[model samples]
Target: MAYTSEENYNPEDYLKDTLNKLDIGFVKVSNDDIILNHNLTFNKIFGYNHEKDLFGTKNLDYWLNSEERNKFREVLFKNGIVKKYITPAKKLDGEMIFLQITFKLNKNSKGEIISSEGIFIDVSERIKTEQKLKESEEKYRVFMETAKLEDLKASLYEKDLLARIFMDNISGFVVLLRPSTREIIAMNNYAKDMGGIPGLTCYSTIGQSENPCPWCLSPKLWKTGEAQHLVVDALDVTWDTYWNPISDNLYLHYGFDVTDQAKREKNLKELNQIKSQLLRRASHELKTPLVSIKGFTDLLLKLKTEEFQSKSLPIVQEIKDGCSRLELLVNDIILASKLESSQIILSKSLENVSELIFSAVKVLKGFSHARKQKILFDLHEEMFTMLDKDRIQEVLTNIISNAIKYTPKNGTIKLKSKTSKGYFVIMIEDNGIGFTSEEEKNIFTQFGKIERYGQGFDVVSEGSGLGLYIAKKILTKHKGAFG
Candidate 1:
């Protein structure tokens, strides 16, 4: 059982040499707590350079206190062995590290404990890593809890701000009421201005009643969970009221004041009635005088009195012309009013389209002669359809007269008639003083005028401005398309 090493050897020495060659540290401590033998790794683990450097100088008890050493001995004696026994120990340099050791009891042949042997493994790095991981998890948990509380607080603040903004900026009166007692719980400024108050019944405040009004809708809303609506008249104003249930026993009451709109509509109706009466009376008062003036002028022109004819012919003609213009103006105003009121009923019948255009041309030819303008007619595919002959003639006369009035002395007015797509189309075009695009848009609108001087007249002349308006309405009644 002995091995020769320079003539002084034993099995224990050979075992110690073999243990030192391996990575693990080995220790043998005798009874009485004296260090017997240890490997070089054991010395290095405790910050010593060599195995001989840690002999009996410091026993295992030196690294641990008496209490922990006794606990280690008790466990070893009870279990007969200790595996992975982790304990805190001090190094030779006075620094602390965690260690794991497995212990086995070394006994003699008589069963008397002699010494203790164990394996030592450094676990300081592993312990430090685990401590750091635990600390990091604690920090993260605290941060998440704090962030959650802050977010909840911010959300509540945002909701409160939005509710206040809505209540203050709303246009009409608004109130929140408790359905059972009809108590006003919340209200906006407009509601307060209308005598609403918290803890007051709506029937008492708004309806001036000792009890709940019969028209109060909160009871119905509580039963059906649906909104109710009504109209109320108070303080000379009309209110459109609505009741909406927001919660189990809470209802929203809102109303709009419509007094001003109603008054405006009533005033417009009265004004229209007065306008119709005035036009009717003016038509009668003006037409009679115009007819007599034209009649006397015609009678004087036909007289055989040579003295009167030579001296007063031009004067009579001037008076007759003035009467004719006045008559035209009155007629246009009356016709435009009738068209607007839908009073002009058409008696549509078959008519000669060509004859209508020719008659209009013949009447306007004298005006064209005075202006030295030529009227050219291009009747293409003349056909008859259902039309009011008088109205059609009036439309034609207005269009041709407008052309003569606008055209220069030598400008030619071209009147064309054609049938296209089952409708008769008439186009009256003149080259002199044509309207701009902007003017053309409102040309057929009543009293819509573009400021411009005449092409050949000494001064600018804008006629009644209703000529095209009346013509357009006539075409509209006949369901005829025009531009």
Candidate 2:
């Protein structure tokens, strides 16, 4: 009833209550082997009626065989503890029963064995299950050892098959070299097929005086611990060679001719760069002459302001119009160069989309006026977003300028900005052309445009074929949405 122990505590009532209510077995005795305690588990486990029936009147060994009693005496003398062990008991009805009992040998103040206390469990089923588990574990251990040996045999067979095929049928020169001494050690059938001279090394076959050529992949193998792949133009054989270290001493080298592929790729890249450069150069150069013509035509308009003659104004406007076309050619080239050189960095800012468009149109007011193209902005003033102001302006300018240059006079170039389907949409509409579906798809691909068509003026000025490509790259970097 009370859980704490005071200095003046008593325990006779507490012990009786616990023994009567709990499922435990215990016994107490004096130095002369007289029973003092017994619990319910003892009665239920061995078919005893009451503690008095098996107490001081009987010897404790009456429940154990002579051999087991001797074992208990010897173990108690040594360890003072006896684990769960089987014992035989004789019941009053003349029936025999078996018990799994554990015992603790207790000593008195004289340090002599007095009586014993113990907690015993009925583990007949548990012991049987444990024995079965022990047997199963041993069998599984044997099975695992056998499976491992079979796996090793299968792995070795696979390696043997690969080695045979590699040696006999592999293409090109597969030579093994000793890096330390720079000597030829082994060669596959392909190596022999290419040049079967004995005592000749990879350096000799490739016409290199040095053992490790400048493009040799041996250094990569040493650094990364993996096969190194690359193409090289050897003095004697132009091929794509893959190098690997088969072991610390032996290097495996193999390759085939790639001269035609190399030549085509190199020439194509150079041609593309040249064309882009022309677009940039043409745009920069034409700016000066166009400025001169537009400036003079404006001077003429200002002089005739008082009595503006419509007929003469139209002729003056025609000259200004020609200058505007030249300016567009220049703008396209400059935009293309920025895209080609990887110099296009889109800067992000929190600003109104409408404001950005208006400012760009203001900057290009003269060009738009000369072409008589109407610039209309369709954006809600309250709508704002985070974007690179200058970059978005440039994109808008490119689309609108192109429309102004290609569309007929008095045509409308509408600039619309709003959100659609979770994206901040910016659309430039012109009757000119919306980049046909096919062109739209490939427009952002670099060298992709050159794969279609750069540099220089009013006659046939085209882009370096990298503006849309570069714009695409920039938008991709910014994670901007594009349809």
Candidate 3:
């Protein structure tokens, strides 16, 4: 409908029409926080079917926090108006939305508040957009920083190899290229001898390809501005290829023949396989005889006292101890071989850590008692986590037994456990001979035993040196750290 003229226009009708057409929701609430009247936009904004569904409802019911309504009223009363007050509100469906509200206190002539009139715009989408933009900016900033670091590393490496790269008599081939066009800009005598020259495309000159080589690293170098290295086979020769970005448009390419190195690596891998097989075989063969020797030694020790003299009895006990130590060594060798070959699989379950620690201490109690040492425990009442029960117990036993062997007579060993930063941590402390910094670095390696000088106490210094190594591997498999 069209208005005839200004003479026929009604101010109330014009205002109502303008408010109804606006995208914002408008509401008039009573002083008691009850909804008095609202526009069609208000009903839609609050997920109502019509104005009747919302009329007579408490305006405070839509506020996410009732205290916010009181604060809003206080602000309106103090200034008689509020503008662009942003807050969270709940819709009819209980979905939280951000709203930007502007309201004014409608007062009578006596300065008594009557009602409040407000317009609110849903600002949830705008808030979400701003958050996404902020995250994108952060990611871009990180990428630029990483790129700059890579460029600096490339510059340093280029500086170190400047003489070798520029000399024509160098053994390896070196050339400069335009990454965008794959054009060779310059080449040393070594590269020239290999049929490469200026004004020729690298892929055609070296790769003998009509198109760009599939293994070319120029594209990746251009993006990351970092050096790239790979081995490629062309012209019946294996080239250890390297590409480094000199600038945005220039790239340094160099490589040497690695055919001999490749052959040696293959031979070394075969030798390792053979070594592992021999170790497994030897461990298996030694295990059966060692078990028999231990069994016989135990039987002799249990024989009647009248059958042997007291001096012979001690010798029999020594034999049993030697057999036990050998058995442990054989077992460690087998386990190490399995670990190196990736054949060890962990069986995990929820187990009580306290119980596992207790069991380990029980197994090593005899050894500690023989040394006149003390073993103390400081653990939680019941701590449960997912781990391999037998494997974890083995780790605890090995570490505890090592503590017993290294500590002096009458020394105290304490085992403690606690949870920190989402991880279960166990610490073993002992008044034992510790390691030097260099020895500590190699302690976790296979056969990396500490060397001792003079010792007064009769401490057990003999071991296969594989205890800590195996313990470390087991803990690593359990996603736990040994140290």
Candidate 4:
């Protein structure tokens, strides 16, 4: 702590003694491999007898193994303090201690290697903790990405990855560009697939292109930072182009194939239009029979009296049967309404085949009798069917009504039912006008009807042609076999 002069200085030993009083280990060795000085902590940390091992040895080989000894000289010449160089040194007590030696060299005026000193800092615990922390960080990052994506409900990161994967397999021009400036800085596997846009001063493999490529959605992306989409039939191939903006100045674009989706949408619209028209016609069909059945039943119910015992039972039963027919008609209307918006709910049950068929045929017979046409029913009594009974009756009634309404009197209408090939084969054959091939294509479709008619026999003006359509939907709910 007092003033000192160089003439009276004991610099080397004084420095070693000063370092010995501190918390760390220190050592100094000469270029000729002679141990010169060391601190007290060096012996304490290495478990050495300070009195005996302080200057006992200084050969670099005395500390480093064969492999480390070779690298030791090179490191001393290159860098003074070697990094995490592992070595096991024997103490005066014969105990070996693992050491990490890091130190600096004192070079002389000749620019030659002279002597070196080092700080042997133990880092075993710190290195081990760092490895574990790195592993934990990796696991947490994985978990955070998964949970955060679901909570946010939109995978911004995954969207980037998916867009990359989508473009990878696609054979079209793709680009990631700066939106405002329209600088194309990124592209994918098929970047030049479309002969590259030419003549515009945008950054691309083509350098510049005049006309914005048909697939280019940059103009649209400038308006909205989302996937600006366009469908066009160009170059004899339908292309679905998409533009996705990444930032105010960044966007991605690609053209995909959407030919199939376009065709399906067109067909679906046409089919729905046809179905709407058919429902209009089928509603008319239901009301015609419904009005007569209701009118006749009211009159028949009024006619029955206690005095007329012979005819009373038959008349009451007839009225009850007509009421049942009217109930089925009402169910058809419900089915049509639901089917129009595709919202039909079915009440499926274990069906009595004979009962369901007889109930349906009862009304058909009544109609045939009213029209003076002959009809017969032959059904297997013991068979069973899983079905929505109301809807099946709708199918039968539409066909039977069409047959009887079109057939001349004395025409034969047959209702036949039998189990065959794991399904119920219920065929209603009549010697009346049947539909043509063109008409039969969408026969089960809604709003479809026959064109043939007599004077005042307007088929299109009849009940909603939704009968077959509603019937088909009902059968689907029951898992019923359909033709």
Give each model a TM-score.
0.46, 0.37, 0.56, 0.36
Top TM-score model: 3
Task: Estimate candidate 4's RMSD in Å.
Answer: 39.7
Question: What tens digits encode model 1's per-residue C-alpha lDDT throughout 319-387?
Answer: 888989888888888888888778899998988888888988898778888888888878864578889
Candidate 2 lDDT, tens digit per residue, 1-483? 564765443444545444444444555544455666666656665566665455664445445466766676576555555666666655556556555666666654344677776655444333443454345335434543654423222343543333343444443555655556455555556555555333455556544557565435467675665788887666455677767665565565666555654654464455446556655665666798789889988887778655667677777788888788667657756765766666667667888877777787888888878867788878767557777877777766655556675555666788787777777777777765334554455556543331211122221123434556556655666687467
Clashing pairs in 3: none
List RMSD in Å for every model shown.
48.0, 39.0, 33.6, 39.7
* Model 3 segments more than 4 A misplaced: 1-167, 179-183, 189-205, 208-221, 228-241, 352-354, 369-386, 414-423, 456-459, 479-483
Per residue, candidate 3 scores C-alpha lDDT tens digits across 1-483 of 345896775544554555566556889999888888888878777787864557798998889998887898887776566778988899889998888898877756344679989888777765654454345335434644655533323453443343233434545676777777777766667777777656778778864665776336555686777889888886787778778776687676777776765664564455455556567777898999899989988877777546878888888888889899889889999998887777899999999989998998898888889888988889887889999988999888888888998898889999898899988888899988787775776678777665453445546777887999999999999888876
Question: lDDT (0-100) at residue 144 of candidate 3?
Answer: 41
**C-alpha lDDT (0 to 100) for residue 446 of candidate 3:** 73
Clashing pairs in 2: 278-455, 279-455, 347-388
For residue 226, model 4's alpha carbon misses the true position, in angstroms, by 40
